[model samples]
Target: MKRSRNEHNSSQEEQEFLRESKLVARSPQHKEKVKQPEPSMDEIKQMLRDLKKDLHEDMAQIKREIQNDIREMREDIKDTKKELQKNREEMKSMAKEITQMKEEWTREKEELHNKIKEVEDKMERMEKQKIRNNLTITGLPTNTDNEDTLEEALEKMFQTELLLKTKIRRAQKIGQDRCIVEMVEWNDKIKILQGKAKLKGKDIFIDSELTRNEQKIQKNIRDIAREEKKKGAIVKVGYQKLEVNGKKMKWDHRSQKLTEANKLKN
Candidate 1:
């Protein structure tokens, strides 16, 4: 039995050896994958340099894009500046045109004002011509109590003092002391004015009825005449003449005179 047991043991060992040998057989397809060695320092540096070059190219591209954006912005700014300059020029032109129009309007307004003043002066002169047949008697005591009695008194005074065959158009008491008499005919106005010397020294006188402006103008003329009288010049304040020392001096306006070496018509 022991010998059988040893033989059995030997057979089992041999079978086990054979199985191990079969399991451990070297197959050509089952080669071990060899891990590559760690890179050397030079190779590592080359890889890092390649990575740096790529990074630099990307950064350069970004920089070029930024520069293009900046250039576009500058062009936009230039366009905006041009538009602003154009607007400024337009505003200046508009302002100049407005100033010119204002000046023209001012001139036209002044011309219109002057024309209106001239027309008013002409109308006043025409009005004075209409009332040329009227005379204002000074120092004539009017009948203030009654209108008919006043007219009768004026009629009687005219019959006595003025020897004129004239009819009274209207005779009214203007103020408390004076009377305005309107004659019927132009001849009557002449006769009454010519016969004023007859009523002289009786605290009365006759004067042609003139406008207030004309009265002021006559007063100015009389003032000039008074000044000439002081210079021993025989000055008379006529309708439009200043007879200064026997020379008919034309009164233009104010104290200015257009003088001529002409004698006064008798």
Candidate 2:
């Protein structure tokens, strides 16, 4: 009976230990679950290949886009260079035009200066020539009968000194009362003689060269008159033929041979 009780106690102790181990394993917090193993090496390699192919496609598309962008940039650069060249040519043309205009303006300015100088010189010459130093007297009474009356009238009209030189006589007759008077200066005589008409009643005669010649002789007579004691000496005056504006007239002498001789003498 004692041996059997000892065997029974040992079996009961073994059962109790097994029951406590089962309770401990059944508690949720203390349980440890087993994990499945990873996939095989071939499966992992197939996945890696798929990912690599997608990455290659994406890289190729990015490279294509980069190439297109580079091509566009190059074209833009080329167009910009062409535009710059065109602008440079335009600037050169404008510069040439400006230079030409400047040269033309310089020429015009010089020409204008020359024209002004010429005008100034012409004005100076005209001013010098404008000095009026002579006088003219005309229209003495024809029937006044004496040289003294004519000289007095002319002296009063011109307000100048007058000298009576000679009394003109007919060729075969005695002295005619017609005479000539002279001023001291040629310019004074020219002023009085040029373009002057003399009126003797109804006849108006243009002052002839005969009148001028007579005036010259009159000047000589006045010089001779100063040395002569006789105041009434007859003075012989020379004759002349005058051609004016293609018209001819005989003056002073009566003989045609004497007139021809006078012309030859002149």
Candidate 3:
């Protein structure tokens, strides 16, 4: 009787295990676990690929922006170079214009100088011509009986001393002891000037009348000429010139020095 009861207990345990197994297989929670699964390697790889693509797009956009900036900078540098080149060219042109202006000013100055020289020379010649027929006599006795006219007295004096026929255009007492005589004839003026040696013993001096400027120049030349004359040079002075042993000297308006008469520059 104990053996039969033990077999019956063993069969009952097996039947209970089969019933639990069937219930687990048929449950909704167990079916849902069976349907879902962990991700595969291929799906993970596709997500990684999408992330890489986005990163590459961002890098490409940044590269394009940098390239545009570089292009703009190069354009600005090119514009600056052109502006500098234009400025340099303008400077060169202005310098050339300035040089031309200087040359033009120099030429005008020289022309003006020449014109002034010409005018001075013409004036000098005209001034000398005016005094050519005139004579100045110094050391004449003024205390003597006064004649009716100075022209008569001069004519009488020349006739008595040198037997010269005197024909005077005008005559006057210039100072306390001097006389001025103007002759009508140039030849007579020359003759009287040359014949002054005949009146040397009378303590009188004779000279040609000159312009004030020429007289001053003559005085300077006479001073130098006198010194040279004492040293054995044949020196003589005219109104505006001097001759020392055939070498001529004249006053130069430009140089302001007594230079050689013939060799002065125009």
Candidate 4:
């Protein structure tokens, strides 16, 4: 086949390159490759030492970085431990303060209760003093439908039954059958109470008027007196006390019952 002009030029250029390469290979001006001599033991040792030094330096750098990281971690752990210990100490102090507050609250509560009780006793004493000259008449029949009032009826009964002319300051019915009578003179009240024995066989009765506190105390004493009498002991119920075998017993406000008069202080 006939080659094109450009193809013919490319084939000629390849042949020229081959001929030039052959000449350059055979010429003395182009020096032959020298044979490399084997390394001596000293040189080989030096190379190994250089390589080891480089590797050791790299390894030392890595070890230092790791040690620094470990130190930082230890510091963090120490800091965390210190924070935890501080929290524990704070909690202990708060617990101690709470305990102290609780004890103080309890003591103050008891003192407040005692002060309130003292106030109540003082008020009760003043109330009892006001009604000292009053008397209570039980089992005295009152006719509400009759024209005669309770006061007129009581005055007539006192004059007829006790043979005494006592001037009453006030006369009022308290409950269903009881009459509270306030006498003008303290001596008149004393005489009326002494004359109560005359109406013993009849259904009438007379007794001193008592305050609410005194009534409660009298009730407690009567209960104790009844129990003592059941045990064959000599027992008597007084104003607000009980006499058991000649031993005087008073009402204890704290215990809310009768206690021996001597032991009441204790």
Backbone clashes in model 1, listed as residue pairs: none
**Which of the two candidates, 1 or 2, achieves a greater TM-score against the reference?**
1
Write down the lDDT of every candidate, Cα atoms only.
0.79, 0.54, 0.83, 0.87
* Model 4 poorest ten-residue lDDT run: 142-151
Cα lDDT over the full model 2: 0.54
Candidate 2 Cα misplacement greater than 4 A, ranges? 1-36, 131-266
Model 1 Cα lDDT, one tens digit per residue, 77-97: 999999999999999999999
Give the winner by TM-score. 4
Ranking by lDDT: 4, 3, 1, 2
For each candidate, C-alpha RMSD in Å? 11.4, 22.6, 11.7, 8.0
Residue-level error in angstroms, candidate 2, position 115: 2.2
- Tens-place lDDT digits, model 2, residues 155-203: 5544432232322221111124333444445565554454243223423
Ten-residue segment with the worst summed lDDT in candidate 3?
140-149
Using lDDT as the measure, which candidate wins? 4
Query: What TM-score, over all chains together, does every model reach?
Result: 0.53, 0.37, 0.58, 0.60
When 2 and 4 are scored with lDDT, the better candidate is 4
* Poorly placed runs, candidate 4 (over 4 Å): 1-40, 43-66, 96-115, 144-148, 155-165, 194-201, 217-249, 260-262
Q: After superposition, how far is residue 86 of candidate 4 from its true place, in Å?
A: 3.6
**Which ranges in model 3 have alpha carbons more than 4 Å from their true place?**
1-73, 143-148, 161-163, 201-203, 219-254, 260-266
In terms of lDDT, model 1 sits at 0.79
